[model samples]
Target: MNQQTNSEAKEFGSLLLDVGVYLLSSGASCSRIRITMRRLAIAYNYSPHISIAPKSISLALNDEADNALFSGMRTTPAQGVNFKTISGISRLSWNASENDLSVQQVRDELSRLIALPHYPRLVILLFVSVAGSAFCFTFGGTLLEMIITFGATFCGLFMRQEAIKHKFNPYICVYIGALVASLFAGAFVKAGLNINFEHAFATSVLYLIPGVPLINCFTDLIDGNILNGVVRGINALMFALAIALGLLSAMLIYNLK
Candidate 1:
């Protein structure tokens, strides 16, 4: 390859890797990331080869006409779920493919999408807490149980968010959230609240469940990505174990039967 062609290949490979990394970190399934990146590559008149792993993604950009190839791998740690980002990037891929966008234009749009802010912290806390209460109610909890569950869920999630902001280990953060929530609900039980305190205690920590990871795990397996699926499955199990250990600690402290 000539100098200019080689440079162009490198640039494209880097950009494609960035896209794959962002998608993976944002909680897109392995298949989704591969499909999206392939779409983008074909749009730019290049062929793409991709391999996704739990903590990394590898991409290669090939130009058949010139027989030029550029390949690279990028680390893509779990960044937490952001469906908005996934959707935005999917749309961007289609737009790029249809409009034949320049590399710079695609880069600008990707930047804009990544820069978008999430919902307000308080807003998330409120809604998620409410959902916890709803779960309690669905399981035949009384009004008081629901109320206590709401408080426990709110406090727990707030602490989790704080811990995340402080860059604590993610599993440790889950444990902290579960501990705080269960403690709050367990306190009411220890106080002889004369209600179904068990219900509140059981449901308060439900918010800590890693629903997305579990779903993604199954999806990856069904899509024939066994390695990624197993990795995700193990990750989900760890989170569940964290929650269980935290709740168990609370039960031991409160001596709850």
Candidate 2:
């Protein structure tokens, strides 16, 4: 095996690992991350081994021609899925398989995909507010309750985004979101808004639920990824706890009982 060939194998291995870690941190299920990464390695004619954990991923690659081994690990940064980004990565993997693209070409394609823009802040806020209103309606809330819930959800999500912009701890941001939402609910009731107070209060905070983590917990469990499932479940529970604490504090302060 020539040194140049071995070096290229190592470089490809590292890049493959990076792609897998990005997917994992971006809220892709563990199974998907594993499958997509393995498929990419297979396309490149390399034997790939991967280990995924809650916060990190490790990968090893073996080059048959050079009889060389390359291994790398990347700690995943906290990131949420932009569906467009995930779709782009999926397409890139498919293209690499069908086209048998070289490592450099694959890297260029990945660079372009990764640069795709995310949804604007206003769009996210509007959608989340609508979702919160939907949840309230599904819970049999009155029209007035839904209106107050929408306003509370909007303001809560706005606070969350601001906190994120300032790089606050994520859990802290969740806490603030719940606090603001619940406080608004309390204020509406205090002002004698014609609403179902309990329903509005509960639904206002619904936007802060960690829906992805809760769904992924069951997914990982059913897939026999027990450790990851347990971890995700615990993370979801912590978020729920933070939300409860925040809402409780607000209720107490506003004499909402």
Candidate 3:
């Protein structure tokens, strides 16, 4: 019975990891999946591995699914043994890893997701651009401020629709664009542009900071995975800082003009 339990625990751990990895590859933040999977591991009394790559996880899931579907095998999470259980894992697995592929492949997949019938991430992004701009124009502390910020954000986003079509590295592009785009924002500031460089720069950094990882770190903490959680939090904070510093430098330069 002890051996059986141990075996079961391992299987469930792997399944959970694979599923989580699939989700990460599909665009869910790494921190989100890491936190979620760690909890699942503890709940099932399984030892979980750290930082499984999304691509690797997705491929494993695909292989598992193909073997199960074609060979009449089913996965049973509760038992920790994959049998003909006919559970929802298969569908969930498919949904998670369907888009797992190379960088070029991911870009293609992203384009498809953006063009999907139900939800267009691009449209939402466009909205963010306009809303963000409106807020910069008018202080973001009020609804009116948001309107202006969002408007400018929208303009940046809309104006670059063609750029997105080129299938380039959007994260890097947006980060760089924010520097140039923010100059326009700085110009739009009310009170005759006497905004303090440091404060304005700090506040502007919130627009795209990777807050998800910080939240994910706490989630990991809740699951008692202190080391991994802390690491993820630190990494995320580093990225957030980079973004802030980049914005700050850009703002300082613009202020000199």
- What are the root-mean-square deviations of the candidates from the true structure over C-alphas? 1.2, 1.5, 11.5
For TM-score, the strongest prediction is: 1
Q: Candidate 1 lDDT, tens digit per residue, 46-143?
A: 88888897888887777867474898999975588999889999999999999888888989999899899999998999999999999999999999
Candidate 3 has a TM-score of: 0.49
Task: After superposing candidate 3 on the true structure, give the runs of residues whose Cα lies further than 4 Å from its correct spot.
Answer: 1-18, 26-118, 130-148, 155-174, 190-205
Query: How well is each residue in 195-241 modelled by candidate 3, as lDDT tens digits?
Result: 44333433343455555557766776777657656776886766665
Question: lDDT (0-100) at residue 247 of candidate 2?
Answer: 93
lDDT of each: 0.91, 0.86, 0.46
Show pairs that collide, candidate 1: none
Q: Evaluated with lDDT, which candidate comes out highest?
A: 1
Position 209, candidate 3: lDDT: 56
Ranking by TM-score: 1, 2, 3
Report the lDDT of model 1 for residue 253: 92
Comparing 1 with 2 on TM-score, the higher-scoring candidate is 1
Between candidates 1 and 3, the lDDT winner: 1
* Per-prediction TM-score: 0.97, 0.95, 0.49
